[model samples]
Target chain A: MKTIKSLHARHHELSDTHHQLEVLNSEIFTRHYLPTFREKLKTSGLLPLKPTGIEVFQMNVGYMCNQTCKHCHVDAGPDRTEVMTKETMKQCLEVIINHTIKSVDITGGAPEMNPDFRWFIEELRKEYSGEIIVRCNLTIILANGKYLDLPDFYKKHNIRVVSSLPFYNADKTDRQRGEGVFAKSIEALKMLNKAGFGKQDTGLILDLVYNPSGAFLPAEQSLLEADFKRELKDHFDIEFNNLLSITNLPISRFLDYLIETDNYEDYMEELVLAYNPKAAEGVMCRNTISVDHAGNLYDCDFNQMLKLQIESKAGTHISEFDLESLNERNIVINQHCFGCTAGAGSGCQGTTT
Target chain B: MQKTYYDPADLKKFGDIAEYGQDLADKFFNWYNDVFKDGALSSREKCLIALAVSHAIQCPYCIDAYTSDSIKRGASEEQMMEAVHVAGAIRGGASLVHGVQMMNKAKKMLM
Candidate 1:
């Protein structure tokens, strides 16, 4: 059950140009949530949130994935044919090498599925000395013959692997991701452990990510990390370096879930009520730029998925790289930004606080 | 001019107890804050415990506060409901177990 295919089949995706997110145009989510969020920010003295600077360059390689998770904002899946061609990738590399970007986080339905994924990393390593992160969905390691050596590949390149494991147990994870995903994920983790990916002394980092199974904010990151560490270690002897707790933004399939369950208003209300200005100031958008498969730039991955390209005169495509103009650009925000500011706040790197 | 039981707004003004006796209220507030801080049990677990106890005591304000607090801290609706059930079972058991005492007294007196 690929995420994009399943979501499209279920929601009858409105337009291809909208990245299949046009179904989120319901007035209630847009009109109602925005006013409430604006009012809350007004109360918290955090009105008019603006970007700080970009340090991280997040690239979405494609929308092809092995698994279709329910809460996935990407709506990535196997049936999708979209992929980042070598030409666009070259443009991205040119921008990265010329700029002072600190991190390059590669993501996709499963970024490894891209034929040029390894070659691109190798190329980046040649020029960029900064951190390189791969947003992996663990099951991908066990998906096919080509991916069997992913752990070894990651080790050789010293790429940080950040994988998603919805829960410590199989039942919850399988229920969210797919039927057989949990067992495969565990097997993959054990492989990572064998490869020294999660070992303490090893610089090769392996971080697991957690997102709520339903419409709720994530629990405290530290506590959840402890629980995950204990359960995974005691049960399967799985070891990981860190756990990232991410808030589920109301976009893509998650937004569809909100609408389908009629929890859109209530969930938005919870986000607004839990607004913390400290979190807003540290939002990933303030320090990161998200570039989509077509080489278009955005303030964050969420903005990219929504097609909210950078509002600047230098042009939003990577071919027109203007670090000075991008640095001065104001971040584009909406009601959904409350997801990043709620509770401890959330971002690609986990809790902002 | 106005009389009502359990005003919803009273939950927000809970700190106003200091209005009557400033010293004791300050002590209570500090104690309350310390008790809820992260410790042997996380604030999240403590919120669940508080939610269960609120149901047992039938305190509307505690329920409202802890309901929002637990949700803000990431407790699911299902988990919250399960906690309330735990409280219900305890309260129900507390009443049911005393029947053993009633039976013992009845046998002793009648005989």
Candidate 2:
């Protein structure tokens, strides 16, 4: 397999968020006669999309990852030096302590890579009793001896571990992720299972995320979940709570891949044509606020990557969080928003509709 | 006239067939939708089968439609290619089977 590098590491043009946004808003959309996501939403009676509430507070702890997965929207990789300091994490924790957010989702290039990851989680556990979700890349658990006990640590903290295992088999999974990722993921899953994360009657929740390895949109989430459950159980004796099938939004590395493969127009048309008003109404951005490593706030992770900060008058960083103002702020939309509204809809948890 | 009979864009206009014959088109599409629903043979399995038949009949539109349909139904690329191979095998076998008749006729004529 060919070695893949983060767009940022290679200093690729798409690594620049503005360049990515420009590509998304370029002439191909007009040539294809596809409506802007806002236009589509307006036609569906959903213009100026506003939040329902801030139910989930997602923090991107860092951009340093062990592996450079091709579809990463963050362009996260081993070479990335940007990581959240304990000070920034404290600011995030302060907001969590003051707010009534239902879930605190910690993500990253690999959230575990942050030196203060455990300290931050330990601190948050002390003051906030709400659900804490750590988006673990399964292989990260096996990436180093220092991280081997991650599954146990998560079990101790009762953190819901959502790991990405792109496919059940090696070939497809490794094709999207790096080679040997599948084997390590399976081993990590076994360790997670041993830690009682995905076992029956164990309150420790372990959910696997699946995004299509190609330009195509993901299949029906329930059907794909059933397939994953059966395949994992039969082949590897692995168990998990649920599967979250995410659509690869055309941004960052994925957007680069789409353009490279000459599938950009077709894939965008697919997303636009499959747009569901129902899905648009239930988009994750409506209830989730994503905070980046530096503590800046955005509607969701995708928007955070695009540098689309919250439009709230109150503030745009975690230190200046205003729940009421943030809730009223209209979500920043572009053509990429169509990815979330396509088919059954996609989000951090899975299908919205 | 267009240079070619098939335009890939025509696939998107398939629903427009209703403009010319609304009742028949409606009936055909409803039945088509029902036929692809999950049954004893899974929808994924049916998609693979349709993809193979698309190859056997050599319908460009059906080929295009079922290729995407197969992927969306979660049939792996390997599984899809195997289905096309099944169609290839059957079509090849049909031609080879007729060789037996030709051989018998030639033998009788020579005798």
Q: What is the TM-score of chain B in candidate 2?
A: 0.94
**TM-score of every candidate:** 0.85, 0.96
Candidate 2 overall Cα lDDT vs. reference?
Answer: 0.93
| Per-residue error (Å), model 1, residue B2 | 19
Error of 2 at A300 (Å): 0.3
Residue A3, model 2: Cα distance from true site in angstroms = 4.9
Query: How far in Å is the alpha carbon of B15 misplaced in model 1?
Result: 12
State iRMS for model 1: 2.2
Enumerate the candidates' DockQ scores in order.
Answer: 0.43, 0.86
Could you tell me the interface RMSD of model 2? 0.6
Q: Write the per-residue lDDT of candidate 2 for residues A1-353, one digit (tens) a residue.
A: 23477888788999888898899899977898888897899999988898999999999999999988989999999889999999999999888899898999999999999999999999999888889999999989988899999988998788999999999899999988998999999999999999999899989999999999999999888899999999999999999999999999999999999999999999999999999999999999999999999989999999999998889989898888898899889999988999999999999999899
> Model 1: runs farther than 4 Å from truth?
A1-4, A9-50, B1-35, B54-89
DockQ of 2: 0.86
